[model samples]
Structures are given as structure tokens and as C-alpha cells.
Target: MTQAFEGIRIVDFSQVLAGPFASGQLAMLGADVIKVEQPGVGDQMRTTMANNKLADLKLSPGFMGVNANKRAITVDLKHPDAKEIIHRLLADADVLLENFKAGVIKRLGYDYDAVRAVKPDIIYCSVSGYGQQGPMAGKAAYDGAIQAVSGMMGITGTPESGPMRAGYMPADISTGITAAFAISSALFRRTHTGEGQHLDVSMLDSAMTIMSPNLNKYLATREEPALVGNTSPTFQGTANTWPTKDGHMQVSVITDRMTATLVQALGKPEWADDPRFTTSQGRVEHADEVKALIGDVLAAETTAHWIERLGNEGIPTAPVNSLKQLMEFPQLEHRGILATVPAPPGVEGELTMTGAGFHASNGEPKVTSAGPRLGQHTEEVLAELGYDAAAIQAFRDNDVI
Candidate 1:
């Protein structure tokens, strides 16, 4: 069966995580994505996390993760010839994705209007720190900066540690997801109307959107929410990572029935009778005492012991797995969530990419090709746009490819 986006062609000018990740999802759904890069040096991520100091900067695991299933082509957009080449490619393209700062694309002469002049139905997406018309549009922002600006950092750490950036780049990842959804929606709209529109996605906006409940509560009460660490505010002390005999286990007892069951499992059912622990609100009020009591009981059992017992009792509990543990997880294997893909040539490693999140009865998502080597498809892609052999050679010789 044909993949979802079989005939779609995407001109991807996105460099780092957010834009590339969004395009990667499209590629997985069978869009033909050509990643545009600068000549000599490709994406900045190609050197961001090089393993060995003296090694060539072209090999980066960070680059490999988000850039899978796309082709790469080098182009010096600063050069007149290269600009002409990009316009020629855009003539038949379905989508154009970029992650430059606000106004940068317009400055480069490849804004939505410029692209629309060439391809009237081209879906143009711009991913930025803020957005196109905001007061902070031109302000520089990386993942950490966005986290601070979005109140994500404020709610991250424990009360004792002040504000802290999350362990991972939540802003970048969240924005990537948002961009993918927006692009997919745009593609669907294009199917109906045969018209394309510009999409402006903001990392700060995406991050703040994820924190709506907390922000809304603060607005209503005129009080800022304190950092609650691993516990969620709505769960009211019902969710947390507790210490087991072997390691830590995360447990969520959202309802009173589950809480009572957990108390019985720990041979402390009397705790459920306590007025301070009777209701969810009361539990939240005396969360520290209730947590200490639960901790004392959980510390007596090993993680494996509790896992089996909890599973049998219908309590939602799991070991807090590391990446290594997760890779070897039995359930993930059974569910076919992970699969190995060949690494790029000369990379000396293979990568484990995830399959689609959910199975489809109608059709399977395709992985057409692995991530392209820098500018690997320059000649092939340009040729598809009707560039003859001599013209392609001239473009390459001029360092305009």
C-alpha cells in the first residue's frame, strides 16, 4: 500500500532539532524531504556534540537522531545562482520548512511571498523562538532560554534548588511535535482546497501552551504555583517516585480505591482510616506525612517484587527505567516500538529508530531511506528539476551548490 504522503515533496531548510524533527515525521509518512544545507559546513548540529575532539566534526549522534529519512543537498543561498536554483526547486515543491529567526527568511529573499510567487500551493512553515510579529520576535533563544521564558524552568526543580532547566530540552521537543501537527494539518487543508498557507510556530508559545492549567490557575488565584518536583498538582500527592529495596518505582493512585488498595498491599490499611489521609484534598494537605508513610512501606520491597504485586493488584506502578533499561524492556519489544536502521555510510554505527506510535489497519508507514549524507542528493534533486548535466556541473564548480 502507498504511504500517507507518497507524492509530497518537501524542501527542508530546517537545520537543528525542531524543524528537522518535524520534517522527519513527514518523511516517515512518505514525503520526499530534501534537506538544504550550506556548502562546506552543513547543519550546525553536525559539530555540536562530536565525540572525539580531533575527529572530523561531521559525525554527531545528535544530528543523526532527528535527521533520519531525508535527503540532503548543499546550497549557498547567499549566491545569486543558488537563489535561482532554490526558486527553481520550489516551483514544484509541496512544502518549504525553515527555522530561522523571525524576518531572517524575508531578509534572505525566500519569505512566504517569494516562495508563493514560484509555487502558489507551497506549504511554507517557519519555526522561530517567539513568532513573526511579537515584540520579542528577533530576540535570540535556544532551548534553555525558551524553558526559562515559558515558565517551564520555574516549575521544574524542587523548592530547595530554586529554578532549574529540565533534564532534556523540553521546549525543542515540544515545538517539534507542535510543528509536525501543524504541518500535517496544513497538508490536510491543502488536499481539500488546493491552497497552501504559511505556518508560524514558536518554541516559547508551544512550551507555554503545554503549561495552560498551571498558568490558568495562577491567573485566577493571583498566586504563582510552587515547584512540586515529580508530583503533579492535580494528582494531589497521588503520584510520585518512591524508593524500593532495589531501585525507584513510580506509582500513581489517583482514586481512593487505588489508595486503599495500596494501603492494604503495604499491610497498613489503617492509614486509610486517618482523617488527614481520608480524602484526596486531605492527602494533599498532609502530603509529606502520607508520603513518608508510603515510603516506609515501599522501602521494604524490591522493585521487581513491587512490580509484580502492583500489576496483580491493578495499581499503576512501574520502575523508573533508564535509557539502557528501556531499550531492553520486554513490553516495548512485544509492542514492536523499536527497530534498527542502518547508519549512514562511514558513520561506523547503527541507529535504533522508533516505528509509528500506533499501528494502522489500513496501511503501514514507510521508512523510504535513511538520513542523507551532507549534500548527497544535490545532483539527483537538481536533475529532477530539469537541470541538465552540464548546468549541474557548472553550478557545482561555482561553489553555488
Candidate 2:
């Protein structure tokens, strides 16, 4: 496989979304990622599949969504001998990832200080709800809770809906992606400096970065923007999602040219001539009026009709697609961003997971497998560690594996 991380090894003690996603991205790039879950129960994400049918196989779609190309092993971290297993893995691992609550990994004796002792050049990353030394560091936080703390929920929904959580865990997912990016960059830095360091990634900090545009606006104005659903929060009403006769479409009126074109496309060229619509800022000030005029005419036609006409006129507009529609998007199919992998045992057909969000000239990414089953690689990995059958059986009998 022509993957970037082919020679790297990652031992991840992270659970749930953020940590798994980060390791999964590295795995997609062909890292030998060992995902260590608790014995017997495994990572909680294996059961977070919700109503999906693959829970019996211990590979939920939600789990498979990020765990492709990973080797999972179950080790009870609370056990005294767990440190030996972790040290053995870290002796060869280039990176270590964990997302347990603050101080948990350190208490378990696998923290950055301990890990670097085993491998001085190891990149150790700890993802937490807050940072390692914040007032909220000790508090338990999940995605939804972090979203609220990070001001995402406050600005996510419409004013009418009050504060609403995102449908998916953006905090967890984006944090994971950020962690992977940082991990790769850290490795690059090590190549030059011959040093490795601890990385502290906070979900709250990540959320703020995701809200940077809005946060910038707030800092400048000294006031948080009110929740305006389906509207551009930075530019206010200039960009909006309008209901077409058959469906909804988002139209961006960021520049004067685009606004004029939109007005002309609506057969209201005279509207752009008005002083209220003369400048882009003026148009933004009168955004409601602009949207009403455009949305009225747009509401008379189907989304496809508006998209075709607006696209030809150089107006930025597109049909608001649902999740399934996005999955079936022709552009995505052509781009080959997703790959279908072997179905986990007992499941039918195949499972599709996304790649590393780019194309490689050598070949496609090495995302070749689905999420690992519970303890699926435990015996195999132990054997590779020079544990004979008797020792393996003893570990199993002692409930250590």
C-alpha cells in the first residue's frame, strides 16, 4: 500500500469518538495502530451503533466509521500487569494517543513522563474535555457537553429553537482530526529536532477554533452573535438557505457582483440600483429585504431550476442535500473519497469508510479493513510479542488480556 504512515506504529488508549477518530486517520494512512480497549467490554463506541444491526459482531457502524485499518486488543488497564503490555507496545510505537479524563493515564502509570522514559522519541498525545491544567480539567465531558461549554450549542440552532446540540459530535470528530494533524506535524518536527513532546488537545479549545469566524466577530463586536439558523453567522443574512418550491437551497451573496447577479436572476435588476443595495455592507444591512425578494421568486421554482439558472449566471447557489444525498453525490463518487472495505465477521456485504480527504498519485490510501472485533488481534499480537501459547493461555486465564 502506498500510504504515508506505512512505517509508523500508534498505540491508542483513547476511547469513544475523538481519540479513535484521530488514530483511525493515522491508520487510514497505513500506520499500525493498536487500539487498546478494556477487556470484556471493549470501547464504548462498539455499542454506540445505536439501532444498527452489527452490535452482535462488536463492530458497530459508528465504531467502523473511524476504526477502519486498525488492530484492536482488549487489555484491562486497571490490572497491575497492564503496564507491561503497554510498555511492550510503546517500546516500538512512534506515537501514543489517549483521551481519558485528566490524570487518568498518569495514574495508570502510562502518562507522558512514564512513556517518554520507555521511548524518548515517542509523541504522546492526551485528548481531554479541557486542557491538562484548567479549572474544568477534572470534570467529565462528552461531545454534547463540550459543545455547550464551547459555545457551539449556543450558536448552532435557530433563535426559535433556543440552544440546540448538533446532530453529530463535531467536538469529538474535529478534535480527532486535529489530533491526527498535530501528531503528523509533531513527527515531522522530530525528524529535524530529534525530540518528542507531549501534546495537550482540548475539546473546548478545538470547538473554539471551529467557531473561529464567529469568535472573531464576537471579539471585535464584544457581543456574541445571536443564533440564526441556516444563515451565515459572520456576514449575517447575506448568505441564507431559502425554501424552493420543491426543496431548499443555499445562496451566497457575499460580494456586490453576486448580489447584483442574484437580483438580476430574480428579474429585479432595479432592486440592485437602490442605495440600500448599493454596497455589500448595505446589502448586508438590508439582508432580510434582499432575501425576501430573492426567496419569493426562488420559492416559485424548484431547487434544480434555481441551481441551474443561478449557476449559469455565476450566482453561488446549491441545493441543500441531506446526508444520504451527500453519500450518493456524483462528485463524491468521481472523487473516490470513500472506500468499501471487507465486512466484519457475521455482517453481510461491505462497509464504506472515508479516506484521508485527499488523493495520492502513487495509489489510493491503505484503508483496507473495517473496525476490529473485540479482542480480535489479542492472541495474534501477543504471539508477535514473543508470548508462547502457555503464557497467552495464562494471561487469558488470569483475565489480563
Candidate 3:
């Protein structure tokens, strides 16, 4: 069946996490995404060694994660004739995406205005550290920097840890997902207005947007929440992790009724009537006592025992799973979050990649192919753009592509 974005074409001039991630989403939805990278070197993420998985995949885990289901080609954007190649690609594309340090795309002469001059209704998106203009516009940024600046790090981890970053880079991942949503919205808007616009996606802005709920609470109460580890500030001990006989298990009691269920599950039926942990507010106020009481009881059993026993009582509980353990989870198979694609050059068997999470009513998301090697599609793409042997050789001689 034809997918949601079957006929849409995207000229992806982005790299690393945020930009490639956005275009990769388009590719999954059946858009034709052509990834443009610097000649020879390619994306720096291509070298990211994600636990020796690169050997079997021929690309780094980071690159493979975000770059599947798209075509890749390299062009020397610094070369004078490079502008000709970029505009030629944009001439028929529906969207153009780039993430450069501030003022760089414009300096390269393919900013929104220049690209729009080629395709009148193309959606142009720019991702950067900050918005187009601000005090920190020129500052170099990555996941950790934005996490620190946006107060995400401050609110995460434990008091003893003192402002630790999240286990994974939420800033980059969230920004990429948000940019895809924005581009999708813009595509929908074009149906009505017959117009296209430029999108300025700032990683800092994306970080702050995700922190809105906590920020709003702080603003209303004028009180900063404590950084209690493994527990949400809103509920404290109610949604926290506890040590078990073997490993650890996470539990959450959202309502007063659920607290009673947890109490019974812990074999402390009398504590269900105790005022110290009766309500959500009370649990937050006496979090230390509540955590200690539950921790003591939970330490008596293995994670499997608690998960089954608590789950039977309708209490939310789960064992803390390592990456390797998660890979063996049965739920993932049912959900189809993992898929296999043909391996890229040099890699042996079929390569697995994470699929787009949601299912469309008409068709499910797909990963058509594995990640591309540096400029693997360069010759084929250039030939399709009407570059014959002589002109192609001339570009090669001049290092234009």
C-alpha cells in the first residue's frame, strides 16, 4: 500500500542527530529523502562507535539509528559550482532541511530565500543551537550543553549526583522529533494556503518546551523542586525505584486508591489506613518514610515476584531492564518497533533498525534500506539529475561533488 508521504521529496542538507533524525522520519513515512553530506568525510556521527555494533553494520550506531531509509550523496558545498547542484536538487523537492551553525547556510548561499527561489512551495527548515538571532545564537551547542542551559540537567538525577544529564541525550532526540512534527504541520498547512515557509528550530527552545510542565509549576508556586533521584518531583516517593532481592523494580502509585493497592501488595494492609501515605500529597510530604517502608519490604523478594504480585493487584510495576535484556523483550516483537533491512556494503546479514513508533490507519511505517555509505548514491543521483559522463567528470575534476 502507498504510505502517507509517498510522493513527497526531501532534499536533506542536515547531519548528526537532529536534522538527519527529522528527515529519517520522513523517509519512514515514505517520503523520498536525499541526504546531502560533505564529500569524503561525511557526517561526524558516521564515526560514533556505539559499543562495537559498527563492525557488523559498516556505520556507527548513531548514524545507523537516524540515517536508514534514505539516499545519501556528498557534495562539496564550499565549491563555487556546488550551488548549481544544490539548487538543481531543490528544483523538484517538496522540503529542504539543514542544521548548520548560525549564519552558515546563508553564507553557503542556500538559505530559505535562495532555496525558495528554486522551488516556490518548498518547506525549508533550519535547526541550530538557538533561534536565528539571540545572545547565544553563535555559540556551539550539543546535547549536553543544551541540557545544562535549559535546566533539564538541573531537575534530573539525585541530590547527591547534583545536576546530572539524562542517560541519553533527550535534547537532540526531542528536537528531531519536534522538527518532524513542525514539518508535517507545515505540509498540512500548504494544502490550504498554497504557500511554504521557513522554520527556525532551536535545540534550546525545544528543550524548554519539553520542560514546560515543571517550569509552570515552579512559576506558580515560586518554589524550586528538589532533585530526588529516580523519583518524579510531582509525586516524590509514589513514583520511585526500589532495590529488590536480585536487582531493582520501579513502581508508581498515582491515586489514593492505587496507594492502597500498593500497601496490600507489600503485605502492609494496616499502612493503607495510615495518614502518612494515604494521599498523593501526603506521600510527597512524607516521601522518606514511605520510601523506606516500601524499600524494606521490596528487598525481601526478587523483581519477578514483585512484578507478578503487584501487577495482579493492578499496581504499575516494572523491572529495571538493561539494554541487552530489552532487546529480548517479547512486547517489542508484538509492537513491531524493531525491523530488519538489507545490510549496507560489507555488512553481512540483514540489519535491524528502530521503526517509527506509531501505526497509520492506512499503512504502517517502514525502513526500506540500511544506512548508506559515504556518497554511495552519488553517481546514480547525479545521473538522474541529468549530469552525463562529461559534466560529472568535470564536477569530479573540480571537486564540486
Candidate 4:
């Protein structure tokens, strides 16, 4: 079966996380993505967090994570011959994804207007921190900065610990997912309108949208969310993390039925008849008392024991898994969300990387190859642009590609 983006081609000029992640999603679904990078330096992420050996090979685990299923080419956009080459590539391209700071792409002469001049129906997507035209446009931002500014950190930790960013790159990952959705939507719209789109995806905007539940509460009630730490927004004593004999386990006994099940699981069915623990509101009023009771009971049992006992009772429960534990999770082996691809050059065997979040009936997301080495397909891509061998060599000598 044909994939969703089987015939689509993208010129991806994004790096680091957000832009590359967006394009990577399309590539996984069969878009022909050509990742354009500098001649030698390549993407900053290629070596950002890599160790000495991986950095020397320009194959950082972080880079390999998002760049699978794409080709790589080098180009000096500042070089005079660059325009001709880019025009050739754009002539048949359906999408252009970039994450440069606002005005940077324009300064390099590949703004939407110039690109539109070449491919009138091209989907131009620009991913940035604050957006294309704003008071904070062009300002430098990273995941941590976005988290702090987006109020994500403010509501994350306990009041004692103050604000804290999430352990993962929520802002960058959310922005990438948002951009991918926006680009896909644009493609869908173009089918009927036959007009291209300019997508301005902002990490800040995406973060705000992701926090709509908290933001909407503030908007309606004019109240700020408190730092609750591992506490559920429902404020129910039964919906919080507790220490077990072996480890930490989180539970969400939201509804009365679930709470009853939880109490039964704890061998405390008598609590169900108590007035202070009968209803959801009653539980909230006696949160501390109820929490202490649950904690005392849970602390006597092993995490694995409760997982099985409470899980069988229909209570939402999970153990806080470390990275090692998560990687070895048995359920993940069946999910197919992790793809095993051939190792990049100099590596042996296979490398396991993440793919799409969900599965499909057909044309499921996959990684055909590991992320490309820097400029690994420069000659091939240039040759496809109608550049002869000698012309390609000349561009290399001139540092134009």
C-alpha cells in the first residue's frame, strides 16, 4: 500500500530537535527528505552531547534519534552558485522545513517569497521559539528556556523545591509534533485549494496549547496552578504517588468506583463507609488523612505486589520506571514504536531508535536507514540536480557545497 507521504519530497534545513523531528516524522511515513547541512561542521546536534568517539564520527545518539530515513547533502547557502542549486532542488519539492531564527533564512535569501517564486505550491514551514514575527522573534531559545517561560516549570515541582523543568525535552518534542501536524494539515488543504501554505510553528505557542487545561482554568477562575509534584490535578488523596516496599508507585483512583476498588485492593473496605472518604469531595477535604492511611498501607507492600493486586482491581497504577527499566519494558517490545535500523558507518550490528507513537493498519511508520553521515549523499543529490561530475567537484573545491 502507498504510504501517506510516499510521493512527497522535502528539503529539510532544520537542525537540533524541533525542525528535524518534524521532518523526521514525515520521512518515516515515506516522504523523500533530503537533509541539507554545512559541508564539514554539519548539524550542531551531531556532536552536541556525543562522547569523544561518537563526536569524532559525527554520529551522536541524539542526532541518530531523529534523522533516520533521510538523505544528507551539504551546501553553502552563502555561495553564489547555491541559489541555482537550491532552485533546482525546489523545483520538484513539495515541502521546505527550516528552524533557523527569524530573518536568518531571509538573510540567506530563501524566504517564503523567494521559495514561492521557484515552486509556487511549495509548503514552507518555519519552526522557531517565539514565531516568525513577534516582539521575541529571533531571540535564542532552548528547551529549558521554553519550559521556564511557558509556565511548565512553575507547576511541575513541589512548592518546597520550587519550579523545575521536566526531565524530558517537552517543549522541543511538542513543537515538533505540532509542526508535523501543521505541515500535514497544509498538505491536506492544498489538495482542495491547490494553493501552498506558509506554516509558522512556534515552540512557545505549542507549549501554551499543551497547557490548555491549566491555562483555561486560570482564564476562567483567575487562579494559578500550584506546584503539586506527583499529585494529580483532581486533588484526590487516592490519586498520588506513594512509596512501596521496593519502589515508588503512582495510582489514579479518580472515580468513586475506582476508589472503592483501590480501598478493596488495600484490604481496607471499611474505609468506603467512612463519611470523610465516601465521596470525591469528602476525600479532598480529608486528603492528608486519607493519604497517610494509603501511604502506610502501600509502604508495607512491594511495588510489584501492588502493581498486580491493584492493577487486577481496575485501579490506574504504574511504577516510576527508570530509563533502564523502561528500555527493558516487556510491553514496549510488542508496540513497534521502537525501530531497529542498520548502524551508521563505523558502527557494528543494529541501532534501536524511536519511531511514530502509534501503529497503523498499513504503511506504518518505519526507519529505512540510520541517520546519514554528514554530506553522505552530496554527490548523489547534486547529480540528481543535473550537475555533472566535474561541476560537482568544482563546487566542492570552492566550498560551495
Q: lDDT of all predictions, in order shown?
A: 0.83, 0.85, 0.87, 0.91
lDDT of 4 by residue, 133-167 (tens): 86999998899999999999988999899999998
Q: Considering every candidate listed, which one attains the maximal lDDT?
A: 4
Decoy 3 TM-score against native = 0.97
**Residue range 1-401, candidate 3, lDDT tens digits:** 88888889999888889889988888899999999888877888887765565743438866886998889898999899998888789888999998988889888889888888888899999888887898888678999999999999888878788999988888998899989999999999999999999998999999999989999998899888778888866665668899999999999886888888888878999998888778877888898888888899999999999999999998988889998979987788788888888888876688887989888778678887877988889888889899998998899888877
Models 1 onward score TM values of: 0.95, 0.95, 0.97, 0.98
lDDT for 218 in candidate 1 is: 84
Candidate 3 worst ten-residue window by lDDT? 49-58
| By lDDT: ranked, best first | 4, 3, 2, 1
What TM-score, to 2 decimals, does candidate 1 have?
Answer: 0.95
Best by TM-score: 4
Candidate 4: give the clashing pairs.
none
Tens-digit lDDT track for model 1 on 169-229? 7898889889989999998998899999999999999998888888898889988778887
RMSD (CA, Å), candidate 3 to true, equals 1.6
Candidate 1 residue 95 C-alpha distance from true site, Å: 0.7
- Weakest 10 consecutive residues of candidate 4 by summed lDDT: 253-262
